[model samples]
Target: MTVPVSPRHDETFVLNLGPQHPATHGVLRVKLTMDGEYIVKAEPVLGYIHRMHEKLAEASTFAQFMPNTARMDYLHALAFNHGWALVVEKAAGIEVPERAEYIRVITVELNRIASHLLWWAAFLLDLGGFTPLLYAFDDREKIIDLLERITGSRLTYCYMRFGGVYNDIDDEFIKGTRDFIKRLRGRMPRLYHDLVTHNIILIKRIKDIGIISAEQCRRYGATGPVARGSGIDYDVRKHEPYSVYPEFDFDVPVFNEGDSMARYMVRMHEMEQSMRIIEQALDKLPEGPVMAKVPKVLKPGAGYYYSAVETARGSLGHRLVCNGDKNPYKLKLRSPTFSNLSLYGEVAEGMLLADALALMGSLDLVIPEIDR
Candidate 1:
């Protein structure tokens, strides 16, 4: 049995939070030590929903592993899918066609916007506000619709090919995306910022609560907005530019506040940056073969390969060891949520139950991604 940390010099109460709580956003069990309603310490106990995705990936061929990507981060399946595809492409020196690269950027950016929107909704809902949930879904639904036309699925899409995308985008898809970006950009200020960012209650709830400093972030291996919130000045998209990210013009938002509000601001700014990337991708759209010329039977040389991509949650890495055989010998996923969740125990200390919940929300953990 693990001993609970006492918030005070003496006298401490142990609080059992959920494997069923709404604030957790998934089936997460947190052991919290409390001094009244304020959390003295927080510990996350995982594996309730673990599917052994790494084990499953090792049993599948290079071509077959793409579907498993979606199962990890269902909210941002395309980003996960792209990460897997890019790694395989890089390992075998397979070149993706120009048009395919452009399509990949567009779809991934759209999915990113959707993931951030969902986080905004859930984060607000966790803080006792309900309207943002519906508003976020309204915008997210547009992206889902635009992607479903080609991907043939919404939640868990298997749309990416090894060296390219599975299908070519049409005029209707491009036009729909243009309209969606415009509508979302116009509404975000009114619906998200004015209604939530400036709300006195939200400000009081998150401003200085559940803080994590720059040093603590380094200790915890934090990445993405969580690291950026502490002024880390690191974004995998920029540090390790992949896909068409090198061609895009956007800024990685950073903040030095190192609190829940800073994390929230980072995500909001990222959404704007994602919109900018989408508009540029749409305008610079090219035409060519969407599918690359790949072999019917892939036998990559036995070697270890590591690839990382910036998901909406953070940096997602896939490490694989192939044996020049039909299937992967070993596979490992370095999920952003895994690193982000590690900071929860340290940061949630001395925070109220509501503040802890908000802090977890700001981390933007998709439990499936972590547990996988």
Candidate 2:
């Protein structure tokens, strides 16, 4: 329903787009000012899911805060785990083993694919398609099973440790990943691209709808698919180059359209790139111990340390302040969803209510990360 905006009406109405609505995707409420079916403004109300994550980090030891990272962005918990591990390792001067680095890369890429799959399913659902959700979840289940073999948990994983990962990938896991990669590559063209990407309805609903200029993305600090869709080409893994990511060769997808379809296509292409990375990591998988040698007590020098990783949404960063104590003095998280959602108020204005929801879904928000 791409309803055109009418001239300024004599009256407008206020609508609450739910703290419990499915379209909001979490405990988020958007106070939308509407002129008929056109949105005049959208203000997202947060804090429904806030659990004082940073405060918990300050109160607990460095190791104690590991599980909390997963809870923030439950779908892409591995990226959060990787970011925390990197910051702690940076502060403690810990060098990870070569084999462990490769393992981390493999599992993280797997998690990224799982995240994008979930996003695809949910986004399609938002647009009133149910069959794709079933197909996407059927594929995502394989990734979860593979990760569950090593990580031991399904949704929120604390698999990564300060120097290395909690467990190593076995031969079965390797074979399973390879088989899944082959299966997905074959299905992408028939199941996803031909079925959805080329559909005239989806293209018309998303293409050139809710156009966001590159300058608007910069002003709001939007990253991940949102920024890349606007042709920014800023990926933390490629531009910042952390962990074993530099060792893998992959292309960062960039689309200049700056619309919902552009963002959707960016993620669709990113899943393929992630598969390429996983394949390369498995090919060059080194043989050695997964864990590095380190002391039990982790107390870095009295200073500030920072680390960032490319998560499914965008750049997830952790800033740590230490006083040479077992517990961090201060912990701050830079979650990309917060920055991406911040621009909704500006962009949603004058857009049809349905189109605004499409734009919001394109941002691929995880509310716990923003509320954290």
Candidate 3:
């Protein structure tokens, strides 16, 4: 319970909640105006890690810009890769092979699980629970290993190409993925939910804290778990129906409470849904060539094209302007975290300092994506 404080306007002090704080997850700083233990205002300071990604996109060719997408959201790089590939394909009128589409779904889902595991570990660490981090990382490593076997990089993967993917998944990769899925399914109920999610302390810390209404989510254009937690059933994969997502049957986890715990629970349930997608994709995996045949110098006819993908964070969109050239005339990236963070100033007002950080953690921000 928050006790009301009667203080003069002059009594407030400014606090910088880090461009270096561990709880921030990356180079993000919140300028907090405080009146005793309560927050007066919270403004997020961005561009500490900006890499000029959009400008780089303009300069590089369609193929050259593929690696740049991975750097924006390092945790779920494949989603960025998919968004770029999709926009290019949409503009160039390239048709992907059936087998490649399944591969894309499988790999992207695995990346989503890895991204969530890291967020889970880090969010628990923010709330002063260290044990969950150990278990989460232990599980995340298995995904990294599986992805590394095919993608060739551990962290920022540039796997997806313009039409399909760069390579194919072998039987060993298939078997490893199935075994990991079974292992995580057996462990989540006991190790994750029982050990952490239903804990009394966690509930107390987040259950009614950082309330974001459904209206506020819409106002801020918040997507993924943040919007779903606030009772918005808008998912790019489902609503827009991209790639092979139409074939899969999975529920978009939603919680109407709209608190920090609600946001946390949405992500927890989403991991299960992602697993379901991967399993279905694997079972229905078609046999054929992975990459599509293309011209030596690619050029989409002069026009504009756009594509959006549901990443671990939220909806990542790629808008491209082509002038019948190999290079994109203009490239605009709409990163979800940028819009999500815009609501912090409104949400953090009057919150306790500790609770505000908890609220920020629940947003699961990746600074590079926002800064880019």
Q: Kindly indicate the candidate among 1 and 3 with the higher lDDT.
A: 3
User: Per-residue error at 216 for model 3, in Å?
Assistant: 0.6
Give TM per candidate. 0.96, 0.98, 0.98
Residue lDDT tens for model 3, 1-372? 334455468899999999999989899999988998898878999999998988897788899999999999999999999999899999999999999999999999999999999999999999999999999999999999999999999999999987789989999999999999999999999999999998999999999899899999998999989999999998999999889999999999989999999999999999999999999999999999999997756899999788999999899988889999888999989999999989988988888999988999999999999999
All candidates' lDDT scores? 0.88, 0.93, 0.92
CA lDDT of 83 in candidate 3? 90
Q: Which stretches of candidate 1 lie over 4 Å from their true place?
A: 1-10
The stretch of ten residues in a row with the least summed lDDT in candidate 2 is 1-10
Which residue runs does candidate 2 get wrong by more than 4 Å?
A: 1-10
| Tens-digit per-residue lDDT, 1-372, candidate 1 | 113345574767787788888888888999988887777778999988999988787777888888888988999999999999988887778999988999998899899999999999888888889988999999999999999998999989999998799999998998999899889889978888898899898999899877889998888889999999999999888999999889989999999998889999999999889989988988888878998899966777789999999999889998878888877788889999899899888877766787788788889989999999
Number of backbone collisions per candidate: 0, 0, 0
Each prediction's Cα RMSD? Answer: 2.7, 1.3, 1.1
State model 3's lDDT.
0.92
Q: What lDDT does model 1 reach?
A: 0.88
lDDT at residue 237 of model 2 (Cα atoms): 95
Please give the distance, in angstroms, between residue 47's alpha carbon in candidate 1 and its true position after superposition: 0.4
